[model samples]
Target chain A: MSTRGQTHLWVVQRVTAMILAVAVLVHLVTIIGAVRGGLSAAEILGRTRGNGAWFAFYAVFALSAGLHGAIGLRNMAAETIGLRGRGADIAWLAIGLVTAGFGIRAAYGLFA
Target chain B: MAEPASLKVSVWRGGEQGDFARYEVPARANQTVLDVVTHIQRELDPSLAYRFACRVGMCGSCAMTVNGRARWTCRTHVRKVVGADGELELRPLANLPVIRDLAADLAPFFDKWQRAQGRFQPKDAPDGAVPEDFVVVPPASKARREADAGIECIGCAVCYASCDVVAWNPDYLGPAALNRAWTLVNDVRDGAHGDRLDAVAGDAGCHSCHSTQSCTERCPKNLDPSSAIAGLKRRLFWDTLLGRR
Candidate 1:
């Protein structure tokens, strides 16, 4: 990867970190409130199903978490085990794609 | 309170594959760690190898590991580091190749400095003639202040020795070099601003800094390389966003 690519990753990491900061807080609070209010998994899905706004929100939340986590793990892998360069980049990309894939699938499942 | 008659010192004996050699030296009032090593080299064992110049702390030539911490031996008094049992352990600085008893090979450290583009390149006129007019920069200007904040580095490499990132990644440019680049990056008259920023943007450059503040903690000059590195990160972040690089 070029230096620009690394810089892009650095920026992406920072921006996604901010997204995760808010997303995680909202996610935790909402989940806690919902579960404590006696909403089961079926009731939660029933409330979220066919809702475009909820689908978009959850999808963005999941995507941001996936990217944020992958970048952080990429850094840890590089620092702790010396996994870096093109191979490391491709590996992390695969991990991020897989995570986003599953996350979007789950979000769609909840919505539909 | 009475002082001990003699102190037991354990000095590294050889290069990469060496062990500590024990020696007893007379304890004195207000003695530095360098003084104890000198006593061993001069009176006890002439073969003991170490490096020191300008017995005062100005030159930064006498840095060594005293009791598991990188420090300027010339500036570290015995009373400050001596164990409760009146013992001192001396070795070469960490994160660099050990050359001998108390000297580390600084070649890699200096090479990374060059790789980080730590040197200044003065801006030149289009006609390639030296400008006769003096470039006046206000002392209190933000740029000059940023440059001044990191300009007191004595090239001690104490931060390099103390950095965990350097230990984890040898290719990562250590704090001193990155801090030097930060100073040059903030120089208004510097011609290589973009080039220097690019030089220090990637994995082995300023991005690798973990922001542990170990450099700031261990610096003998009280300089904050950690903040300088943060400055570089902000510069690169903006440059990347603005497509300036």
Candidate 2:
């Protein structure tokens, strides 16, 4: 990858990390609130279903996690396993795409 | 006075890949690690190759992986770094391609310096008027002190050799380049602040740093290049937001 593209990835990783941080906290709090109130999975789904804000929040969370985790793993693989260059780049892109697809599918299942 | 005890040294021999050749030399009081290497080359094996210039540590040519750590051989006392049994394992620095026995290729290491725009770029020549006196900088300023702390790098690749980032990403500018950029960023007289910052802003630049702090730990000058790079990142973020870049 070009130096500029590499740098952009670095910046994107950090920005995604920030997004994940907040999303994770909110997700954890929501879970605790639901469990403490003794709400069933059906009741939780009732509140979340057809909610645009919930869909958007979960979508962003999943996308950020996929991007951040895949990039981080890509770097780790390069350093630890000597996986680098175009092959590694393509592999990481595949990993990110698969992760985002599965994550968004799960999030969609929660709403639909 | 009685003669000092001998030090059994195992120095790496050959190029790129090599094995260590053992040599026994008499150790003197107040002897440095460089002294041991020099004695082995001169007395035992003339074929053994190594690099060094100033014996007092001014020139950074004497840096080597002594006892598994990158250090200035001239300044490193054998007693301090050697094993408890008084044996020394000397080899060339890591990450860079080795040229010969105890001499790694420095071309890639130095090229990053230029890539980072480490050199000072003047804005304009002093026309007829003597350039309005020296630019006064207060020592107590936080930015000035932070800059001064990492400014004393003598082009030694000690920090560069010790860095993990350089090992992982070959294109990464390494610590010396980033550190040099940090010094220039703090320099009030340097005209290429914006350009320099832009040069060091991206991935191969300051953002590649994982902050392992190996550079700070290995620095004989005790300069913290990692912190300086972080400062550059913070400054660049602000600059980019304010349209300063």
DockQ of 2: 0.43
Instruction: Please give the lDDT score at residue B157 for candidate 1.
Output: 88
Question: How many angstroms is residue B42 displaced in model 1 relative to the true structure, after the best TM-score fit?
Answer: 0.7
lDDT of 2 at B220: 90
Q: CA shift at A82, candidate 1, in angstroms?
A: 1.9
DockQ each: 0.76, 0.43
Index of the highest-TM-score prediction: 1
Model 2 chain B — which ten-residue stretch has the worst lDDT? B123-132
iRMS values for every prediction: 1.0, 2.9
Candidate 2 matches the true fold with a TM-score of 0.87
The CAPRI-style docking tier of model 1 reads medium
True contacts kept of 1: 0.63
